[model samples]
Target: MAIQKRVGIWIRVSTDMQVKDDSPEHHEQRARYYAQSHDWQVMEVYRLDAVSGKSVMQHPEAQRMLADIRSGHITGLVFSKLARLARSTKELLEFAEIFRQEGADLVSLSENIDTSSPAGRLFFTIISAMAEWEREEIAARVAASVPIRAKLGKSLGGQAPFGYQWSGKEFVVNTTEAPVRALMYQLFLQLQRKKSTAQELNRRGYRTRNGTQFTATTVSRLLRDSTAKGERRANYTQTTGNNKQWVLKPQSEWVIIPCESIISPELWEQCNGILDNQEAKRRPRGPKPVYLLSGFVKCSCGTTMYVYQSSKNYACKRCKTRISVADIDEIYQVYLKEYLSGINREDYLRQSDQQLQEKKQLLEVTVKERTKLAKRITELVDLRLDGSLTKERYTEQYTPLEERMQQLDVIIPELEAEIDVRNIQLISSDVVLTDAKTLYDEWGSMSLDQKRAIVEVITSKVEITKQDITITLAYATPPSSKSREKVSPRHGFMLAISITFAG
Candidate 1:
């Protein structure tokens, strides 16, 4: 007797409503049926019920499934579809790679993919590429919309400044916070020191919106804000690579919208001028050089390495592992060029464009056919009413026409939707490919700040040891318009490249 192949069933229902509307048990049974057909034993069932598809890898059930695959408890995993497995393209790719490494097969019923076969493996690659392209398109759309929304004086999805609150789409003064905020500027003007201003506010029992005592930093920030003078700045700042720090965007991109004034413009300017004078007086003789990959580079021992004041190398104090700043930059340029070139984007985009055009043409033909069928059915009804044709003949002619029209009704919409998706993918892919090419070709001409921005956007980590340096790249995907989902932690898959270099 032949031994049965052991397999696990994977089910993930993203929402409670979905679980209620569409039976998770149905999905399970379908997988079981697929498994039984192939003489595979149902060894385990992993369920992530009412869970999000964003970052399922950290989920307990997902971890258990991975453990089973790694431990050889199951040589196959059967799921209903790719989206049911994970919405994150990065996570999907990671899962495929892991399964491949473990010599395990993946069976997705809806997609008719079984990784034990060659065609199924090809489907996996195509699906992953399409998902990634869709994600990039969404991100590009969101980025493009930000400045337009800002210029239109629309709320950009954040809390109002300290002194103000959002009343619908309008920026209005917060009744309670406004007084304290106004006092901040007044106190700074009188005391001529941010720390003294904060101390005075704290002594008077004033607190921030978060119910915390005011500090020098808070006082300085509020006093410097132009919102109190009615010119509120929007789209002026953006988060860095790790999404932890906010850095100023270019002045040309900044939008200043008028809002209700909390204080007189003259008074606000007076306060800021004094603060500016103090800053100038305290300014250092020379500015510090900005390192491109500072705070991102880690020593082999796991401590963040940095280039100390005018140093030519990023050194780890704990591990004593060092890499020269110039060498790291050189390696990154080479790595980026090679990485971008390795992507089969040209061939993929060409095929996608062809498919898009075909879909559009099919939709046009479908609509015209549906229209002609409707006309034929109307003419048949007229002929029966006028006694020019028998009722039976009219019915015979109309029934087939109506049925064909119904079929076209279903197909036309699906074709239009597919066309829309493909168009977005093509546009997004073009932008990404153009940017990648520009980044590599213009590396030498780019300013330090420009280079740093690009590095932060793409790189997740840089680890250095005595023998080799590893760079981990993460291409971020923007959230969809529907969910407005925040990018989850380590949201994308990490692409690590090991480079041997002398330190």
Candidate 2:
């Protein structure tokens, strides 16, 4: 008796909900039954979820299926339908050619396409074009609804502005953040410099909506948004590269959205009115100050501390509070000795190694998530190319996926860098302690930049007042001391020591 032919079954679905009944799972089961009835061996079952009609090579298992086919491990390939394999006529024909070249038979159970026969090639072209037309018509209907909703003043459907939250129907004032938004506008009008306004907010312990310290550039973008005046604008553009990104286009082309205003017309006018003058004389920003705790230091009065290069100290430009540079180094010596003492010294390597292991595991998870998103993007592109989905449907899904991909692309690298840094810091804890002590011993010989690098890595913040100094270490379990230690060891150290900085 002749040996039975081996075949692989491929199945795909755009969502998990679709797999429940008579779907990819059921279809796979049906395809297997068909293969068995025909006296064929089921070599493999290839499956993918949330995948669109992209190339087989774009998916993980799909690539394996093709490899098995090309290697002659399987002489036949089967699927429930042609739509699962491809959406466009061109792609359907291409898949047929690949199976032919690999000397494998292609069968689609629903459409009765048996590419080993001549008649199957004719139906493949005619039916795919018809399916493509149907998909385009469905997309056209969805795209037609957008302008109608916009004319009716319905929400355009995206994240709401900074000072407002979407209420399902429309945006309403976010009471907590509206006050901050108003104050930002007020401060900008008074200070005339967005950078100064950001500093003022930071001094008062104000942070952006996301809780990170705000920058001068952040302040400018928020104020210029014009949504505070109840006008939401769109069609903003960005430059392709470098520091000059998010550049706005002509004001005439902007589409202003009508919504509830957070600030008065006069306040809005006064703030933006200064833009022309500011731009005319504004010099390109100078290099950022070189200080160990550049963004981390806070003044006793609560504003950020700026570096005074001449005296080699940190001072608040607004309040004139200053801390001598040498004092911070002096305090570091105290921290290191306390931290590296008897019991803590013994536990250093164990503690660091544990933390590094945890961070590395999280990094691996993030990288995997990023890969899945990349595959989804490939599926979307293929769907759009074959007219399987309309431009509007593609955009609705593609835009957010791309945005998330960008965020992950940024975050993944940062996580990897953190893992690298933590490994170095923890694995070499003894060396860090010894090297730090030695650096202080030869402090006079080290350059300012060298000191900044060491200080930046070890310390998180330095808060200086007229009477005392408080330092926070970047360590997991800080060297314990009885100088008003926080109740929870989880909260990083809030160590305070009395030191006088002469005026």
Which candidate has the top score in lDDT? 1
For candidate 2, the C-alpha RMSD (Å) to the true structure equals 27.3
Candidate closest to the true structure, highest TM-score: 1
lDDT of 1 by residue, 1-503 (tens): 33689999999999999999777876776677667656789999999989999999999999999999999999999887899999997898888867876878898766656664433555556655765576578867887998899999999897898989998888799988898888888888889988999999999999888899999998988887899999999888865542238788899999999999999999999998898888888957787677878777888888898898777889999988877787776666777677666666667568778988988788788888888888888888888989999978878888888888777766654554445445544554554556756786887898988888677545667888776667665431222101111111232322234632210
What TM-score goes with each of the models? 0.37, 0.29
Model 2 lDDT per residue over 259-315, tens place: 788999889888888866788787898876575456667787778786666777778
Which window of ten consecutive residues has the lowest lDDT sum in model 1? Answer: 479-488
- Whole-model lDDT, candidate 2? 0.68
- Report lDDT (Cα) of residue 301, candidate 2: 77
After superposition, candidate 2 runs with Cα above 4 Å error: 1-147, 234-257, 282-503
